[model samples]
Target: MHHAESLYEINDDLTPELMGRVDEVIQRYANRAGALIPVLTECQKIVGYVPVELQEYVAKGLNIPGSTVYGVVTFYSFFSMVPKGRYIIKVCMGTACYVKGIGEVLNRICSEFNMDVGETTEDRRFSLEAVRCLGACGLAPVVVINEDTHGDVSADKIMNILDQYT
Candidate 1:
């Protein structure tokens, strides 16, 4: 876990460390518009998810509207307002997967981790999400452990899969 003080490294009043790093990134790009994406990406890395304070900081640094920055941040599916966990556990709840008893699998995972869909563990070790489709209907009732896929899974299989991760 990061100490509470460490968070100030990114969100505090433009420390020399932060200014030096963010400014260097902004200046590297010939156009401010070109720097937008990289600036947000770098900021996310520094502060976990993009906090409102960081959004204002980024706007001032890039000389863009804060609303504009917020819009871009929220527009992208990849961007998250909340910090993510170490492992992303996506249960396929699409029609095919659901039909094949995906709900039972989801319940087992939620029960074991003591978390609901879209929630990360307090330790930030694992996160659960439900997706529309993983494009593996043949592998119905699928669960993706990060990038690797496990097909035709049962509730009991989830425990074993989680063990591999821990």
Candidate 2:
């Protein structure tokens, strides 16, 4: 068991240094009211995403219920329980984009990256999302990488466009 544990460390992201920072955040807000959000935000900034382990840690630190921490994390759109990629790829699934063959573009990305929608690549290079619409009907078959909007994207052209980012 010791050998196995040594080989595979759990919560590898939560190192002593990061946890110390987290402790500081908890201390700064432990005496204040409505401190959960700010604490979570600060900790997330320190440790990328707020995993369940950190949630329970914060809950214990604040003397709050674990469910309360979980609830707040789930309720807020800004708080993400999972890690995000460096580049976020939003593919429009609106009627206009669909008619313009956006599916092919989306499929191309999934096949090339070996990831479905709402999943991040293994290298953490990109996160794929299929939004209902991007409000750009004229720019059908749109793929937005981070904040850059790419319109009229095709399967053949997607790999080249994505290559520009890295």
Candidate 3:
């Protein structure tokens, strides 16, 4: 966070302070055996999401190939390149939920929020994602906002449920 000439060009979200933290993460794991995943994980934690710029920075710092970094990032479902919303709304797309009218619920959210799956709203208030299942078939048509689960979610009631989040 100290005021200093930044070596790398600053990114939109990757502020000089965050870049400094990323530098610390790289230096901590540099030259260590099997450090790529851990380094990327920590850096992603610091920066919220890992873009190509941070991947290249970590690769250069660790003396590894950028493709190797990109591969690991893309392979891992947990690593995200884009910034996530404050609330992550995961709609269940499993057979039970689908049959129970989860599609209507999903569509309502998309139409209301003007965003599709895997995309965040312009205000970054919420991110919509379609997941295979949430393991609550009894509560079909489920939508999970962050850690809290809402079962038996109807398209009509989805907006009200989302109001709690907003």
Q: Highest lDDT: give the candidate number.
A: 3
Model 2 TM-score, 2 decimals: 0.85
Model 2 ranges with Cα > 4 A deviation: 1-9
Candidate 2 RMSD to the real structure: 4.0
Clashes of 1: 0
Model 1: weakest 10-residue lDDT segment is 1-10
TM-score of each: 0.79, 0.85, 0.88
Q: Which runs in model 1 stand beyond 4 Å of their true positions?
A: 1-24
Q: By lDDT, is 1 or 2 better?
A: 2
- lDDT per residue, candidate 2, 2-63, as tens digits? 12122125577777778888888999999799999999999889987888888888898898
lDDT of each: 0.79, 0.87, 0.88
lDDT of 3 by residue, 54-99 (tens): 8878888888889999999999999998888889999999999999
